[model samples]
Target: MWRRRAPLATACAAGEASLFVNGIDPGYSGDTAVYGALSLVTRADSILVQEVCDYGNYDDFDFTGTSMGFGLTRDDEPPPLFLPGVIISMFGGLVRNIAGHVGVELDEMRQRIEPWYTDERIECAMATIEPGQLAAVRFAAVGVCGGVPVITVEHVTRLTAAAAPHWPYPPDGHIGVHRVVVEGEPRVEVNTHVSHPVFDPTDAGCISTAARAVNTIDWVCRAPSGLFAVADIPPTELIRGVMW
Candidate 1:
């Protein structure tokens, strides 16, 4: 993809700039936030970042019920997002970005998929999920080194809390969260929660996503031109105000 955008890099080299940002999954869920907790990294055998979200209050039917395949039954065709290699296609950059910073040359990429079905009807905020429908899923995109997994991005998402009772839960037992775990280094963990007084987790996520993009504009414009990771850019002052 970057190969096709060679001109963007060239423009950046000529003093123009470009910035790529995303929401919770490839955004705070892994790349930048995952790198922030490396100070305690005595030894990192494996680094895992997770997003555990309960979409019960998220009212976007197109996203939750459709895009994520939350209301589909076992017999229904899998959503395009859940098709083979789709996880890697979506999150491989996140794995590669972290690997590039950790100085690990990944040998291959792999994905783990576990789609859970709802045993009973679910009255979700976005749509109704009948029994046997795909109500939750836990999927991971892993980057390997020497045939061992080194960096991974996982998501355990459900339309409602009752869908995947056996799967991984949020660190704070909340409706939404992003958790990062470094297994070998003191077992350090970082959990980020974004919530609003008036909005649901879905809307909160959307707001924070745009906030990330807006806040990074200055850094991106000042940095050198090229495709880069969060670590590649120079540090700047960060402000958190109530302006939002």
Candidate 2:
């Protein structure tokens, strides 16, 4: 597997680098093709046997097919997206137009989860993403509150694995992942999407594939609570700590 891991803070500062799949571009590549190539990129893609699949089984809940809105803020920053009961996915990657436009509004329509703090308590914890075949961008923002850190993520893309955003797995293809670590808040937030639209799906599995990369690291800070809130943390108890 081809692998690249860098500090999320430094790489994202310039908006030049991506999270999981470093060099891959999301514009011109096929989503399924990217997932198939994971074995060559990180040598860890083979580990997935049943984890990545269609969401029809999950009451038809797919992350790739729909636009994603993820962010971290203090209890007072006004919920980023106002939509109710919306879950963000980390597996599904977003595609971008050549000029770099995501084509979606990230503003919170309604508050789904309450921010934990009010005093600038948000800072980028870390980003774990797959850049994709055409250089798709994944962003994570960080802020400080009461000396604590709050992290937020925003994704913009032109392609998707599903025709609709609520499908379980995209009719298209996706990337795989082994592990991801974001440092800065001592807490971890892992998010991923599992589906995409068929016509213009992009390879996001690369982000999942790079989750196990070892060279990357971020700073960890203390939070009001001891644990962070992320959706995609591997089940160490089930995997016996050998997730990849």
Candidate 3:
């Protein structure tokens, strides 16, 4: 368990650092490996989890076959094969051939733009995924304009029921599920978005936010349905209260 936890921890930490330094959310990159590893260990099968980044807006997660390793993004522009060879060819044909081979490897590595997720696809994924693995299937988007990270985890059963007649929101936005207590029994709540205060970048604040996010996800994933209970105040607010 500790070994399993280490990869995710490293990945999350790296992602947080990338967010602060590059203003790019690489969480999905790290998350891909974590999700893949989790699927393999839990199901004893190889699985490929790919993240499609819309660059500064939102990101979507979906599973693929093991053949699709570290799937490509739309932004990955391919290098010019013949053009580069032409330049080197002026120097020598041998050099040009070498360059072409290198170009081939580069092209192989670059992934094609991943397609956007649809409501039907997400619903299907949710239905097929093991309850315990739901957490890894979650999607998150950091608002580049606002720098706020909105994390979304789904409960398929709840979401399907919620969309009894029709789901109102766009498919992309329907990534979250909520928890509520009704008649002394726990139930899935729909159409609720949980917002937490943006973590302050101060050393202490970052540490606190990371810890709480980990703890919260762990608790939520273990629940019967994959959702977190709403808090009156953001968890960061609570941390501030205690720290201050």
Q: Which is the leading candidate under TM-score?
A: 1
lDDT of 1 by residue, 1-244 (tens): 5774687778766865665555567776686678777767788888988888897777877865686788787788888778889999888888887888788899999999888888899996777888888888888999999889999998888877888898877765678888888887578888988888997767888898877666666666666566655555544522233257
Instruction: Supply candidate 2's per-residue lDDT for 236.
Output: 35
Residue lDDT tens for model 3, 1-244: 2574466557655654211110001221122222323333322111122222111111122322111111222343322311223222222222122223223111111111112222332233223322222111122211111232112111121222222233223234533322211111222121222234563222232343354444344333333422122222233432333432
Output the better candidate (1/3) by lDDT: 1
lDDT of 1 at 163: 81
Residue 149 error for model 3, in Å? 30
Lowest-sum lDDT 10-residue window in model 1: 233-242
- Global fold similarity of model 3 (TM-score): 0.20
Q: Record all residue pairs in model 1 with backbone atoms less than 3 Å apart, i.e. clashing.
A: none
lDDT of 1: 0.78
TM-score of 1: 0.88
